[model samples]
Target: MDKIIESFIEDFKTEFNYEKIDKSKLFEHYVNYVLISKIYPDRSSLDKINVGGTRNPGIDGLAIMTNNHLVTSQEEVDYFIQDADLLDVEFNFIQSKTSESFDMGDIMTFIASVKEFYKDGELLFEDDLLNLRDLKNYIYKNSIKMEKSPSLKLYYATTGKWLGDINLTTIINSGIQDLKSLDLFSDVKFIPVDGDKLKSLYREIKNKITKEIIFEKHTILPKMDKVTESYLGILPVTELVKVTSDDDGELIKTIFYDNVRDFQGFNKVNTGIKTTIERKNANDKFVLLNNGITIVAKTLNKVGSAFKISEFQIVNGCQTSHVLHHMKTSLEPSIFVPLKLIVTTDDDTINDIIRATNSQTEVKNEAFEILKPFHKKLEEFYLTFEKDVNKRLYYERRSRQYFGAKAKSEKIIGLSTQIASYIAMFLNEPQSTQRYFGELLNSYSNRLFLDNHSLFPYYTSGLAINVIEELFRENKLNYTSKKFKYHLLLMFRIQVAGAKVPINISGNKDNEKYCTKIMEALWDRENALKIFKSLELKLESVLAETKVLNRQAYLTRAFTEELLPTISNAKKEGKLIYYNFQKGFGFIKVNNSEDETFVHYTELSKVKINEIVPGLELLFDIFQSPKGAQAKNIEKKDIVKKSI
Candidate 1:
């Protein structure tokens, strides 16, 4: 146990002993505070004592899932998730029994509460505890959104291990399925944070996940300068993916803690990486064509061919790794990417390496100032917005250069244009965002900044922050988890998409209108949730038959595979839906209708001949062939379009 955690526990006990306040509330407070300060940076949770007493609807605390940028697409949503929509508010239905030990019956009681939440929905919260009545109203206020059940996350936090020998993991999963059978929620992710895990989290609150990395002595290259120890080496694609993308994704995120950037929505840069690794002549010329990864680690150890890293972050090569990971079906076991790993504890050096490697590479990365369009518009909006002192939102194109902030402006919040691009592009099209997000500084990234959707940095920041704050402030959400914040964002995406007819928001409009409907509705706290809700029956039918998972689920492809057709069906719009390489042809199942079309490999471009294997998503036009409607001009979806 960490001494800090022990001290916190002692102080908590002492405070409750001196005061007449409930000890359980103090325990809940301790857990909530640790979760906010440690797991979520720049986030806080409302305590049970602060919110409600016995009526607290089975929830102990309320946490805003802020750090979530783009996560999984497991839950079915009406629209694609956007950057701002990514922050989900979750209710922690806490069953914190701070006693020495707990049994199966106690676990069942917690599960039963979760079951009741699903059964009664908001109506149950009418007389329920923890200020949840407000939350219940928020859910029904937008009938369209309420049509679909809210996602519920059940958390059982305890100070003691289970006394019964029953397998809690199995029991929890069974309970989740049971709730599913009851149709209590759109989805339920049950987490039982055992005593050991709870202690681990408590210990982690004080000391973050920083550890020493060791590289085999022979594999590391000598450092050029005494300023720091840097190494150049090679590691198989397997190791790289394993190190960067942990199963649930928390581990890899910890590695990139300082970068303060999430992987851009998937795009061609990442897609090209897929094509590069899957190409026939990869090992021969990949080293020359591709720039190697730039990584930072705390320690390095090199013992023969063995290499171990306590912690590391890839400053560059995010696309390469992401693509290599997603396209692993086509990966070669022996192929390698050149790696340059720097071992340093200095924050300045780490940032320096990131700036240098990103700027000095063959594809030089541009600064956030490139978000001039967004910056300009925001400045204009604020000219008038400033009059409303409480409502003004300042957009910062550069990092910490806002003269207003220098003057200590009360409403100033730093908005890196880089982050704005992330928000705007992601909200516009999740598919395009995924294919292109990582290359924001590259020329290819300009696709995200096209004149179609004018940048609104103030909107970029205001839309997201305000909506998230309102959702939490008004108790409109179900559950919040740092691990599942991505869930909330998905729900928000539906709200924004609901604001405008989906078609008008498309590129069909010569001048695209950035989604302001959700923002406007959110600003006024109107019936925002109605957007996706009314479409539930329609969406359920579509999602039931849909075949692609959105780009967000790519990180956990293995699990996503369990939920097949993992990405957006928008791109696979008119193209070949499914392919069979053995027959050199495939079928395109047009959504809604049971119509199928035939496509042959010969009909598509031969450029990706070898890469044209089964399950390679493609786009094509129908041409008149003797074999009936023939698929022609077929192109792989991941390939970037060249100038005519």
Candidate 2:
């Protein structure tokens, strides 16, 4: 492996906590992460797009995007169907190779797999891929909702350089033609990713993007406190497209508002903008009709007529920008867009600008959530634990707030992740965690991030979520349990502090105490792992008997109600009856019963071999192993220390 690629993989492992995953497979995840981040940098759940498991049919990953949002399950597709009249969907397929060179055989096999994926004939594939296929079918079923035919994109990545060999290009072009014959996609393209390009993609994620544009026509706005400089200008539609696009001329999705108010596909307002651009002699008047694009930059440099902006975001003109980019080819050079460019590193000022500029539009209130006082305080609270590795988590109230910082990506909790984690662990809404962010915010905004809510539980939940995901990546928990991770966090909290809801408001001492208990258990790595393993067993048992692990189960409360008892019942108290310290095996007398459950030293986190004693009251959970019912996750609670 190239040293740079090796370093990239190591960083990927740390950011995603993939150390326990096989090294050979890490390259696939690396490719997926880099490429997907290029499209959706702030997307929280990368695993939802990963399908690189057993019987994957030569494809390493797949992502089905509806209106720029990555849709994993059929439920998400249904939501889009109900939410929007027209959907702009995209199907992305990826194949990654760690080998220094790409083989023609592998390339052909990958292309063939994609071709087969669209076939009506039955074929065996991994469950995740099957789900994606089902989702694809669901989208097609409601073709009326589609704004246009779905776009098909394929990416083949390898460590070798793509020298653009004519033979390889011809082979790939031929394969693309075959797929295009299916007539299922508006456009079909296969992008070859080479070693140098992969490195560039990886750097793009962490680096601040800089773009220079001509700013010949502009009026400087009045300066205000916290604002370094502000300008109102008219920029050519061509130059606006340049700022919105990448080197490949694809729209850079990350450089927009990090909220649910994404590019709404060809809506009335956008259609109006599109119509205005297409009208003869009306292109020059576009600056007067459309609300201009607002550019917020951390730093701006003026060189003659060109202005170079770094770390810029288009705060308010998502709709306009998308429309302009879509109609770029038809746009006349005389077409101009109204531009508002502000330069500031102050988050407060940026947030205010974003809120003010978007207030009149159809943007969701959730878009301005980071501007809330609670989030700002929560951001501060996360810093208090920075020196303590066990409780440390960097709260990202803004997009890429922790970028280039020393914090690991795994430990950097974003607002969406935090909301889901807190709602699951503290509010007991694990089932609702998967719902649309707009819906979650609408329903739970009053309950979460309140002015008086104690910040301790938020931090505790964030840290617990981080730990749980790490355990899942490490395979300490059953892989299936990853789907119900929010449930596991709820269960973990119940096991540590009981099922009672804490009064988690400011000045509430009990809230701090309650959250502290959960924190203590999570702070101890061994104890946390034991608790999660036992909870996984309980989760598996509940899910097996009910056989209700589907979209319906997750969207309803009945499944949560059914699963809660299993976790509540996990608390089994027993007295140690017999032990062999030399061999480290024992039996526990069930609390008020004569039945003895087997126990082992391996389940003990607080005790050593000789620390075991007869008649010591133990708190544990029972796991039905091949041998028999055995006590696992044994806690040395209120030990009597009686002699045998």
Candidate 3:
């Protein structure tokens, strides 16, 4: 296995220029081969024959079926079919190409070439046409057949480098429907090869070809995916000696030895320690000795003696109290205690002394000893640290919300544009809106406009202005005002101005004069202004009366209502009241039991408000009682007031 893997790697480097391949990727290739083999077991034992290349214009390879018949070219495909005695099964053509990558264009080209080879015009013998075209046509015409049958299959085997280059979904979705519609076979399959799979198969083949494969192992660690390596080295240590004065007026010398035998040859070593001791009396002298040799001598004015030693000999010098103190201060705390007993022969003896002395230490000195006992609690705190950090993040978000900071200016601008587009869409119907603008609005809002884009108020206003100007220019209407305000106002209500109309009393001077005067009056400044003011007042009044109505209509139809129904019924026994058609217009009923009081149309004038269309909503104040009911006042509601 190792030899095969190594050979695969070498071959991969040469073929694909990939020096380092992941083991999992290589293994996937072998797995794919095993799966394919299991699915098509019969193909494994077919005899391998070199099919002539396209340059030679002949078969590229020949594969014998279970029977001993030879099938050479596509034209001889039927030979095996008829020779059941010698050929009991069918074989598929395997076209092999060595490529750094495979692509859709390559597949298409291969298919096209195969189609050209078996084309109707390429027949050599009359029977050859029947031999090649029969299988080819059958496969192409019924590519999606639901039943299995004897058929010829085409296989293009190449290095799978191109598999990753294209979207597999696109390739599958693009031609899958067409392929399935062909109904050629019970099923059709496309296989993509990758570099890893190819390497594994190549290794397997190379191992079979060469009985002995060479495997090599490197001592240097291969580059890990996401890791680093570090190194540490041990240094040699030398022995030392020290001298000190004991509390009982006795001179003591201690020898310190190096634990590593490699440093035993060193007799003397430098000491990184300095200390001073005062004598009790004058004229006192002391000499420090190690191994019967006087290493240093010093005199003090006091009775006590003092000595200083800068260097010590490994074999002859003794370790004094000052020397021990210097060693402790010189080395790092982690390694100081371990190195102090280097001169001791038995590690167990030193450990026992350390344990006995540690027990005598006070609680304050043993603070570090609790670390082992509280390790689990420390681990729990570490695990929950992330959760605490998340809570702090949540608190920050809450604070931001509470502060109510304005959105970024850029975002505000973007939102304003989006809202403007939305309002435009709402005013106009969706169908008339530009496709791109509609797309932008819909994408931003994640919704479609309900009203037609053409019916937008702004668009309608522009159209109305255009119609009025056209009428004025044609002399159909007169615009005497400085700015044609009345004409503009009339245009808002002249829904039929743009509609087609037939001329009445054609060529009659009297009729023409009357029509001209009427047009002039309609376009008159005062009249136009009157109409404008009327419509404006009406809009305001309707909105004021129907605060929820306009919003409801906007939510429903996004337009003003043109007309609404009103129904009236007699509520009391009354005689017929005379109708008033001049000043006010409405039904009037007189109460018979009473003194025949008249119920005037003026009493219901509040409900007589107009311009009640799909988009307009009106508010009615009703004076209701058992005797009868009547609307006292009509008004438009304000949405902003209600919102506040």
TM-score list, all predictions: 0.43, 0.84, 0.21
Which structure among the candidates has the greatest lDDT?
A: 2
What's the lDDT for residue 225 in model 3? Answer: 32
lDDT of residue 152 for candidate 3:
38
lDDT for every model?
0.47, 0.82, 0.30
Give the Cα error of residue 469 in candidate 3, in Å.
97
Point out the higher-scoring one by TM-score: 1 or 2: 2
- What would the per-residue lDDT of candidate 1 be over residues 349-398, giving only the tens digit for each residue? 65567666676433323332333454555455645555553355564433
Worst-scoring 10-residue span by lDDT in model 3: 391-400
- For model 3, state the Cα shift of residue 71 in Å: 4.1
For model 3, how does the per-residue alpha-carbon lDDT over 308-411 read when each residue is reduced to its tens digit? 22222122222233233334324231211111111122323333323343343232222222122232232232233234321111101110111123221111
Clashing pairs in 2: none
Candidate order by decreasing TM-score: 2, 1, 3
Q: Best candidate, TM-score-wise? A: 2
